[model samples]
Target: MTDDAVPDLRASDADRERVAEILRDALAEGRLDMAEFEERLDATYQARTYGELAPITRDLPAGNGVAVPPVSLHKEPAPTEGWAGRIVGGEGSSTGAVAVMSGFQRKGRWTVPRKFTCFAFWGGGEIDLREADFADREVEINCIAIMGGMEVIVPPGVEVVVRGVGIMGGFDHREEGVPGDPGAPRVVVTGFAFWGGVGVERKETWAQRQRLKEERQRLKEERRREKLEREAGRRELDGSRHDLLGDLHGRHDPHRERRRGDTA
Candidate 1:
């Protein structure tokens, strides 16, 4: 009979571990992504009955000598994977942006041209290229900060080159020198900052960081709950063992039998 046939039966730690192993194997074979694997893993540990655990691996093949489907090894990598999808070469979304006394911001699904010129005079500006597409493989950003500062944000895996000259201010060279991933775009920041500064930074998109943070928190909380449950189970088992031993000793006591004979 299958586990589902006895769905109401209590599940042991062994049963849960078996299901967890299946999930892990599925993840190793690329059948499950990280998010799905972690979700199923959490469910496996939280399961208290056979019913709860069965659904976690309902579609997966049973492990332990069972023949699994053959994994394909000759599949070509998807063009949409990694940097290939990100480098969309075309005309830039916008040519130039200038901030006089207020501020200018360029972010969110915009395209960067080969030479993007931005000037900030007495007002700060921010250029975020984290989620932006590129018009070319190698593009240049010209920053002119006369009396206001400018900040340029690029995503990880991008190659940054800072060649801007700042008479009284300076351009940030911290993000430079790192080799970019294959097919990834290269960004060059060049221009002058007379009395203002230009800063470059590498950061992931906000949504990506938030998703990762939530996943970590979920895993942490699950671990804490599992720990508490284990401790409680151990205490219960110890108490049961102690009570059983006491009953056995009372039954086998010679003094109790002798007292019964005296009464007779």
Candidate 2:
């Protein structure tokens, strides 16, 4: 049977559970409010067929509540074009950085390999990928921070998955679970931390910020020009009306004079 036909069939507990997961993702992504989520969750459990379940999340970003395909562990990285062009499989420009008592940084125009490792002991390190190319579609950044800190900054549209553990320290995964753009590389962050922290943050590059600023300025100028044009049109319309009324009055004045003369 075709995939669409499956929806007509009865939905099992696993199907409901899958829909629930999608709902959870939607909620986390701020797609649904608490009231809508509770309503949908109740409907999901009571759903008997895929058809009934599909409409609950049909308008969501997850696409009709269908389960997401699991990320394959053994799948080979495939070469692609467009945004994926940034993912050129090869050796990384730099493999790793170590800071014992100071700091290290990897930023700008570098190549991130399939696996890049870093260590920090009583120091800090920064890995910025705003202007970097990926050596593979899937790359892992292994961080080991001991009584120190490490920060990984990525540009918008890149997928980030954080699976690191912290003991008496923390892994800042505020950017985790956010969906990435199509054809963008996926970043997997994993490692350990002891008495230190590793942070993963997503930010717009300088160029991107500049572009947004220019776009806003352009839009503002356009709106201003439009308002000016509308005001000019209104003034022209009022002037025309005034001229037409004056001409009518002038024509009637001669007739009024003739009428008065006849009366005299």
Candidate 3:
């Protein structure tokens, strides 16, 4: 990719860092060899800006390397005990989160509210989310979403990663880790109508946030305990040193010999 393509895609310094992250994931997943990774990464670095990144993605080949599938969205309920209960919303609006994986080869737009998390996938292709619009809210796309073609947009302060075929891009939102068995599905090209959009509102339970906070607190408490233990050990050592000095002084004192002579 050269600096002369896609003149409108303005990316910041942080965006450049994300590009590196995408490349690293691709290399780790065996999508790209060391040499290719370095070459493309250098190209990206030299591009000067996001506008320069467009060409590299424009002429990329198919099978964008990784696999993305639209499996049923699942939610892991927050635990009933402690902090877990707080972040997990009440029973009324408790759906965990939404993930959309596709193999689309055409233009599509899904206007999302600022509160929800969105993930899009494409294969053998260059997909563009550079125009993805959002309000004043944070969104996270796990790095695995972009496998084939690459283009992602976000409001200022929103994060994004792009991975072309043989390159990996995106972020990981799940605290536990990437979910499920990794298997590539047969290539299926399915098309659909653009009508009423699919709406999903995932409410984070109070319990969930509570649990996260508690976990953090627990870590902090553990550190505190370790510090206290170390201090106690130091105090014990100091006391032992004092006792030893007192014993030595008593043994060396000439007053003890005078007392012994008087007793005799």
Q: Could you tell which candidate, 1 or 2, scores higher by TM-score?
A: 1
User: Which residue runs does candidate 2 get wrong by more than 4 Å?
Assistant: 1-79, 99-103, 121-123, 146-148, 178-184, 204-211, 248-264
Which of 1 and 2 is the better model by lDDT?
Answer: 2
Model 1 gets an lDDT of: 0.78
lDDT (10s digit) by residue, model 2, range 1-264: 455555445555566667777876776566886568768876776565566787887787765434432223334223234457688888999899999999999998899999999999999999999999999888999999999999999986687999999999999889887666557799999999999999998877787556445644664575578679989999999999999999899888978889889999
How well is each residue in 48-90 modelled by candidate 3, as lDDT tens digits?
A: 3345554444433324531211111243222223212222222
Candidate 3 runs further than 4 Å off: 1-212
Indicate the TM-score of model 1.
0.64
Which stretches of model 1 miss by more than 4 angstroms? Answer: 1-82, 252-259
Winner by lDDT between candidate 3 and candidate 1: 1
Q: What is the C-alpha RMSD of each candidate to the true structure, in Å?
A: 13.6, 12.1, 21.0
In angstroms, how far off is 40's CA in candidate 3?
Answer: 26
For candidate 3, what is the lDDT?
0.37
Model 3: number of clashes?
30
